[model samples]
Target chain A: MNKYLERLYNGLIKENPTFVLMLGMCPTLAVTSSAINGLGMGLSTTVVLVFSNLLISAFRKVIPDGVRMPAFIVVVASLVTVVQFIMQAYTPSLSDSLGVYIPLIVVNCIILGRAESYASKNPVLPSIFDGLGMGLGFTVGLTLIGLFRELLGAGQIFGFQVLSLSWFTPITIFVMAPGAFLVLACLVAVMNIVRKKMDAKGKPLAAPTGCITGDCAGCGMSATCTGKRTADHTVKTE
Target chain B: MKELLLIAIGSAIVNNVVLSQFLGICPFLGVSKKTETAAGMGGAVVFVITIASFVTALIYKFILANEYLLRKGIDLTYLQTIVFILVIAALVQFVEMFLKKSMPSLYQSLGVYLPLITTNCAVLGVALTNVTKEYNILESVVNGLATAVGFLIAIVLMAGLREKIEYNDIPKPFQGTAIVLVTACLMSIAFMGFSGMI
Candidate 1:
């Protein structure tokens, strides 16, 4: 595989930030009440991630080690504010629906995690692709979860009712908080089962254990995956 | 006072910071494997969140929200994300240093978890929520404390549950985080009973 495609595949399947790595669970569970909300949040985050990764990677050498974490955060927070203003102006309802979460994106582990782990180390293009890959992975993960919940919870997919009203009673719990956990847990378990089968066939999605043993070469957090290197953890060590 | 009490209850139980709002889940899942560590992490979160919220509230009320400051062409509201996150980071650092110097044992127990709180969405979420909800300084502080307490309650309860599950014969696939998450789902279902309690 091409290096760029590798980055994309790395984020999408090999080390999916959501399902495989479990990096950004907060937003994955929060804004995924419906398919549209999940898509909106995911795309918005992708925009932020792509740009932040690009900028952070470009300026990697310039940002001082002592204050790199603070610098990365300032960059991400500014990007989030810009995104928030644009969303508020054009997509008022979407903005309102995602409320507080837009700002909370500043704390979303995926962006900062990517910045610290991949973007800050790699070159500009690869970092950008990495961000796009991770963002897409997160988007797909959230959307799938949203699709499941919305279908069961509201008998709708992206506001279009699929199951006729008389056909079944929408399970209200599927749209609630518990449903988020249940769906995520089930999906992850399914993913594990699939991986087991894949491994039996001599294929593996990601390393069996985390980025441990340095097998995860391009991974951003490889330097201090063990959490012992406080200097590498930066600001939001999520 | 009654209103504050209601807000406290509302944040602490009715709309819990963890189960309901889904903030601060990384620490909720990561540090919750052991009961003692969970309690320590909860205490650290409570301390950091309460203080961070208080400081952010004061910054918002006095500097960001001031009409005089706005008239002078300084709009700090746009900087809330950067400001709030920087504040939380600094505050966590301060707490870590203080703990290490004055209470080494406590610091040793809660060492790595302290840094993680800087990124914990609960702290920043409570700070941002305080602003969005139009909470005054006092209300914001109360909300922060209450939210942290809510986090404390949920994580401690999870820790207790996880301890019990250690001995239970569980299926292979669900042995680790999957089973713990399913447990959390059940807990979330149970906590849902608190809806509308306020």
Candidate 2:
């Protein structure tokens, strides 16, 4: 596979951001009440991620090492602001349904994580691909979760009534806050099962870049991932 | 006063920073393995969020959203995200320096947490939410405090539950974050019960 394809494959399957890296848990659980919300959030994030990655990679030579983070934030914040405005104008309903989350994308860990680990070092083309791949992976993960919740919660998929209203009393809670947590949990567990089976079939999966085993100290983004979480961790060492 | 009380209760219990609003979830899941750390993170979040919200609100009202600027056709409100983030970063640094000089012991405890939260979406989220809700400074601070308290309650409960969960014979796939999330799912449902209170 070429470099671009490899990046796509890696993001979609090998190290899926939602399932494996679990980078941006806040938005993942928040706006995924409907399939449309998830898709919009995902695509908007993709646009921001790709542009930021592209810009950062192009300016890699000029950004001072000491101030790279702030510089990256400015670029990303600008992109996110543009995306938010576009959503508000073009897709007013999605903008409303997504609510404050559209603005909160300024701090989504995946964009920053990709910038820090990929875009800052690699060439421009690859960084863009990396952003695209990661963004799409997150989109798929969110859409799947939203579909399940919408199907079960409102007896509808994308506001179209799928489950017959006569019998399927929309679980209601599934559309609320709890359902987000439950659906993501079940999806991840199923992914885990699939991984185990794939391993048994001699098609081993790649481990996620971040520590899924709860070892933040060893992870690259430990400080931002969890604030001094390692400080109070019993298993951590100097 | 009644309105303030309603806002406090609504933000803390009914809306719930962690369980419902879904801000600060990375720490909610990451630091929640131990009750002690969870509470520490919660406390730090409260401290940071209240101060950040207060400062951001003042800036937005007086500087960014000033009618003087608006009359000049200068709508700097679009710079809200970038400016707020810069302010948060600078504010954390300023606080760290002040704490180290005037309150070393406090710094020792909180210094470790300051940098970690500079990029935390909750800090910026609360700031933006204040503007979106058109909350005054006092109201913003109250909302921030209540939101932090909600986070504290939820994380502490999750940590306590996780400690008990460690001993259970969990299924293979539901071992780590999967089970923790399931626990969170149930907790979210319980939190939903508070919706009627307001």
Q: Where does model 2 exceed 4 Å of error? A: A209-238
Q: What is the TM-score of chain A in candidate 2?
A: 0.88
lDDT tens digits by residue: candidate 1, B33-123: 6788889889888888899999999998887777898888888788888889888878887888898899999888776668767767889
Among these predictions, the greatest DockQ belongs to 2
The estimated TM-scores of all candidates read 0.91, 0.93
Off by over 4 Å in 1: A207-238, B105-112
- For A160-223, candidate 2 gives per-residue lDDT tens digits of 9999999889999888899888887887798789879988999966544333344444333443
TM-score (0 to 1) for chain B of model 2: 0.95
Distance from true position, residue A24, model 1, in Å? 0.6
Q: Could you tell me how far off, in angstroms, the CA of residue B71 lies in candidate 1 after the best superposition?
A: 3.3
- Local accuracy of candidate 1 as per-residue lDDT tens digits, A1-238: 8999999998898888777666677898889999999999999999999999999999999998877878888999899999999999999999999999999888786787789877888999999999999899989988888898999999999999998889779999989999888887786677778879988999865632222111222233234332232222223223
User: Chain B, TM-score, each prediction?
Assistant: 0.94, 0.95
